[model samples]
Target: MLTSVYRLVRPRQFELVFNDITLDKSHVIVHPVRLSICNADQRYYQGLRAENILRKKLPMALIHEAVGRVAFDPTGQFEEGTLVVMIPNTPTEKDDIIAENYLRSSQFRASGFDGFMQEYVSMEPDRLVALPEDVNLSVAAFTEIVSVSYHTIQRFLRFSHSRRDVIGVWGDGNLGYITSLLLKAILPETKVCVFGVNEYKLHDFSFADDVYLISDIPEDFHMDHAFECVGGAASSKAINQIIDYINPEGTISIMGVSEDFAPINTRMILEKGLRLFGSSRSGREDFLGLIKLYNQNPDLINQLEKIVGAEIHVRSIQDITRAFEIDIHKIMGKTIMIWEN
Candidate 1:
């Protein structure tokens, strides 16, 4: 069957390309119903990536965060019309020591292959996770990123010291809000504080134990651990600032994406005996665990509802372009496209 794929032929340009998708019993067909715009997708749409990288990766469908209905399930595991979230990381091999997301052989959607910006996505049943039928569609669209926070926090739990009294999340963006919210649900007894430069954005973290502007933090304030959600050129400053305020031996989980190398203070890291690690795309298990968490805590999804920003109905390339433009101009929050193709 021929499938309609929207590809970015160049910056600020999208072309409708058709590709043949073999109708096989091994693959399940998903009709993407709701797609979320990501910063990575924005980078490609705006030509923010390196020229070489863009030259190689452009003319490819973008968007990894999406939810859809099972249009066809030959395996009989999921029924037709069932709601599901697609996992982007496709692993070629399994390893006991390294998770699938961490494996070098994994092919991530949008990054390594055609993403969900198509009429239909063909993926193995194992790459899809069922979601509650009544779940919020706009909130569900960005499950991929939420699962990243879930995956990172799970690792932080295993790697960090037992001092779970206070945890700091730097950045008041959607990620920081989600990370701090997840930390509260996962570690209710622990305090989660968010730090950011924007007071307006920081106010959105109403659930946080406390929100402080980075420059206004108390002199004696400290946290047992920190998660850096501030990426881009500010990556170095966020990491180094965390180092100064975090307690000795605390684990710093890096979830930010930076194009240029951001030099951090390694001297203080060594002196403080800090442990730093980076987390990116998540695996199937992370999505499963996160959905379970959402089910257990209904209020969690309610909180997620607050971050659902502009929801545009996209039925054509022009609509998709308008959606991306809206996403770029928004101060914060997720921009979702109700995929009508």
Candidate 2:
């Protein structure tokens, strides 16, 4: 048995639990796993599904996106030492629950299965991807978050008519910056504009060419595509702002998770012929593409340094809950976690 760490959540509380992982005697033993905590949180903690599988009246570990290294794997595909990232999404292993369709039934590692906050973790060899030497552990920690942008952008491009479309991303948070970068990376000719609350965050990334602080938005700007990464009432207002600027027949991809309802202009949505949708954890292919980008561009670590606001080691599980309660802006570009064994 190996000792590991896991985060847990309830309707209104957060906790951490130490876990024991054991391999069946028949399974081969693999060694030395590298693990790190993540900065992102789960969408919801209470639901019917949460009660069934985890058997937890409360939820388990909130963070879903992170990067780690595989110390060992029996298959030899992942050897003793490999810098890798885990794609949290996993297909349902349950045979009894037939998903109406594969898309409807897919599961995720941190969501419904085991997650990565631990002293050691044993993962499937095929699930791991070795990182490039240039990728630092801290910046690489955001590989999953970065992929969220990549996946969202690809979805828009795949469904849109033009590759050179103009895109306006709402919010200048880390996700917003990465979304712009991913679009620029894939569609270099695409015009990228950003809506952010803080002018500083907007300037942090070179790719957000046209940035605005809601108060000074350009009314005439037209968008073929837009992304919603703001997660509060403020963000909802930003979404409304996006609606004002989008062109007729435009598409808005919402990837941010919010706790409040921001009214949408239903009439204008119809009048503008808008197609708005949301995205959560990404697909396997998107994660793979993120890895490829991390490998190809050595400077991502440096560029990403601005987004990882701070780092906090886990002294106790209680700290995890407190971590989230603190102002997120104070910790912008920072990562908080309990690091002790």
Candidate 3:
């Protein structure tokens, strides 16, 4: 069968390319139901990435955060019309010592390979996780992002000290909000404090124990653990502040993406005996874990509802462009695309 794929031929340009899809017993074909725009997607769409990187990565389809329905599954693992969340990180090879997401051979959608921006995606049975029938499809669209937070916090729990009293999350963006919410759900006893510059954006973090502007934080305040969700040029400052305010031997999880190298205060890190680690894309296990969390805590989905800023219906290539255009300017929440095409 021939499939229509929307590719980013260049910055601010999209071309619908046709390709033949071979249905095998091992593969499942999924039709995208809803899609969510990501900051990384925006960078590529706006040509904000480095010139060298763009030259190599352009003409690739964008969007990794999405939910789809099984149009055809020859393996019979998932029935046709089953709602599912698509896991974008496809691991070509696995290692015992390293996780699938960390493997160098993993092909992540919207990065080096084509993403879910096609009419139908032909993937392995393992690449899709079934979504609950009652689960909201719009919220499920961004399950990849929620899974990332779930994955990061899961790692943080294993690496951090047992003291679950106070945790600080820096950045008031959607990432910070989702991470804070997950921390609350995972560790209800722990106090999650969010720090950011935008008061307007920070106001949405009502689920957090406390929200404060980075400039207004009390000097005496400190946390046993910290998560730096602030990426980009400002990440350096966020990490520095985390180092200064985090208690000794604290574990810091960095989830931000920055094009240029962001400097950290290694001297302070050493003195404080801080353990810093980075988390990027997630894998199948993370998605399953997130689904379990959703099943356990029905309220979690209600909290996630606050992050839906704009919902754009995408039926044509022009609608996709308009969604990205609107997404670039939104300061808060996630811009979701209801895949009508």
Best by lDDT: 1
Candidate 3: residue 334 Cα off by (Å)? 0.9
Please give the distance, in angstroms, between residue 239's alpha carbon in candidate 2 and its true position after superposition: 2.3
Structural similarity to truth (TM-score) of each candidate: 0.99, 0.81, 0.98
* Best-to-worst ranking by lDDT: 1, 3, 2
Supply candidate 2's per-residue lDDT for 107.
59
For residue 96, model 3's alpha carbon misses the true position, in angstroms, by 1.3
Give the TM-score comparing model 2 with the true structure, all chains together.
Answer: 0.81
Ranked by TM-score from best down, the candidates are 1, 3, 2
- Per-residue CA lDDT of candidate 3, range 1-341, in tens? 99889999889999999989998889999999899999999999999998999999988999999999999998999989999999999999978888899999899999999998999999999999998788888899999999999999988888888987999999999999999999999999999999999999898888899999999999899899999999999999999999999999999999999988888899988998999999988889999999999989999999999989899988888999999999988988899999887
Model 3, residue 324: what's the lDDT?
Answer: 94
Clashes of 2: 17
TM-score of 3: 0.98
- Select the stronger candidate by lDDT from 1 and 2: 1
Clashing pairs in 3: none
Model 1, 24-61: lDDT tens digits are 88999999999999999999999999999998887889
lDDT of 2 by residue, 1-341 (tens): 75645556554355556667776422223222223333334333333233444454334555555555555465656555566676666654544543211355775655555566555655555455667655666666667778777777777776655635688888777677778777777776878888887887788768656788878876677877788888755767877888888888888888876656778888999998888877776666777787777667656556777676556655555655455444243625555343454
lDDT of each: 0.94, 0.63, 0.93
Q: Which ten residues in a row have the lowest lDDT in candidate 2?
A: 25-34
